[model samples]
Every structure is written in C-alpha cells, then in structure tokens.
Target: MAKLALLVATFALAFLVVNASIYRSGHSSCERQIRQEDNLRHCQKYLEEECSDSPYNRPGRYLDSCCQQLENLERECRCEGLQHAVRQQLEEGEWEREEARELFQVAKTILRKCPNFEEPRRCEMQSRRWF
Candidate 1:
C-alpha cells in the first residue's frame, strides 16, 4: 500500500511538471506574439510616417533605394510575427516539427536580408527566450 501511494505521488508530480511546462510554453508563445506585433506595428508606423513623405513616392533612384529598405524592414518584422504564430501552434501541439522548422527558416531568411534593427530585435529576442 505504501509503495502504491508513493507511485501515485510520483505520477501526480510528473503530471504537474509536464502541465506546468506546457503552460509556460504557451505563455511564452503568447508573449512572443505580443512582442512581434508591437515591433511590426512600429515598423509600419515608421514606413507610413517616413517613407510616405519621401520624394520616393514617385519613381526615382533615391525613392527606389528607400522603398527597398523600407520593404525589407517590413518583411522582416512580418516574418518575426509569423514565426511567433507558428511557435504558438507548436506549443499547442497542433503543428509538426517540419512545419515549425519551415516557418523558422522563413523567419531566418527575412532576418538575414536586413541589418539588425537593434531595439526591435532585442525586444523580439527577449520575448522568444522563454521557449
């Protein structure tokens, strides 16, 4: 009887630990989503405010360069947001490893296209660290 009780206790503890880990994983996913959302929003705001006003609104070399950079930044932010969403799905056990890996590769591709935007990257990194 004592051994049975010990087994039950051990099982209960293991269950709680697994549950807690899953819960934390989900929470982290949500937090990462929020962070990515905020960064993407900021990038959008910058494009709207800065690029919209630039003479590049027409078609010229300067405008082309600025627009290209702006587009790259926007794409990077968007990819990070997508990665967070994919991670949430992974945490929920709804996504396979291949899908999650593909999504991560997409995000990495986006990140590779642009130089690091320090402040935004820092926020995104911190939020994803919980995983």
Candidate 2:
C-alpha cells in the first residue's frame, strides 16, 4: 500500500511539472506577441517623428531606416504602419492642418519609394477612404 501511494504521488508531481512548463511556455509566447505589436506601434510613431523632423528636406537616409523598421513587422503591418504613423502624427497636433495634408502627401511619396511597398494603391485608398 505504501508503494502504491508513492507511485501516485510521483505521478501527480510529474503531471504538475508538465503542466507548469506548458503554462510558462504559453505565457511567454503571449507576452512576446504583445511586445511585437507594441514594437510595431512604437516604430510607426518614431517614423512619423523622424519624417516630421526633416520635412521639406531630403529623406534618403532616415526614410530607409524607418521603412526597414516597418518591414521587420509581420507582412500585414508594413504599409498599414506607415498610414498609422501619418495619422498619428496629425493627431499629435504638431503640424497645422495644411501642413498635415502636405505630410500625408509626402508619406504617400515615401510609400512609393520604399522597397517592397505596393505604393500608390494603398496610398490612394488611404486618401479616398481615410483622409
């Protein structure tokens, strides 16, 4: 009877260990996903800030960096990130309404220049549908 009780206790401990590991693995993965989405948001915000900093100037260097950051995101977010960044910039109220419009146009041009971006298509849709 003692041997049987020991075997049951051992089985319970093994079961708890397996469940604990699985829970930790799943929890970490969930955290990673959240962090990735947060990264995407922050990247877009930074891109807008960068663009706003150098408006009316050549953007060859920093634009590349911003596009690269967005490109690193999941395939779904690359272009959407640009749009979000532009809108976010406008919402920040740093630029006048007319200036915001100009920035939107500039963003469209940047979208065209960025490699792997669909260009013009989504940009036009943004103008028609969004603003």
All candidates: TM-score? 0.31, 0.47
Candidate 1 lDDT over residue span 1-131, tens digit each: 99999999999999999999998886666555556454344333322333233454432323233323434444334444534544553454443445445434433433333454433332232234333
Please report, as a residue range, the 10-residue window in candidate 1 with the lowest summed lDDT. Answer: 43-52
lDDT of every predicted structure (CA atoms): 0.45, 0.59
Q: What digit string (tens of lDDT, one per residue) describes model 2 on residues 15-127?
A: 99999999888656544543465544554444455456566544354666666665565544454555666666666657755666666666655555668766333453274
The number of the candidate with the highest lDDT is 2
**Model 2: which ten-residue window has the lowest total lDDT?**
119-128
Model 2 bad stretches (over 4 Å):
1-58, 116-122, 125-131
Candidate 1: residue 24 Cα off by (Å): 0.5
TM-score of 1: 0.31
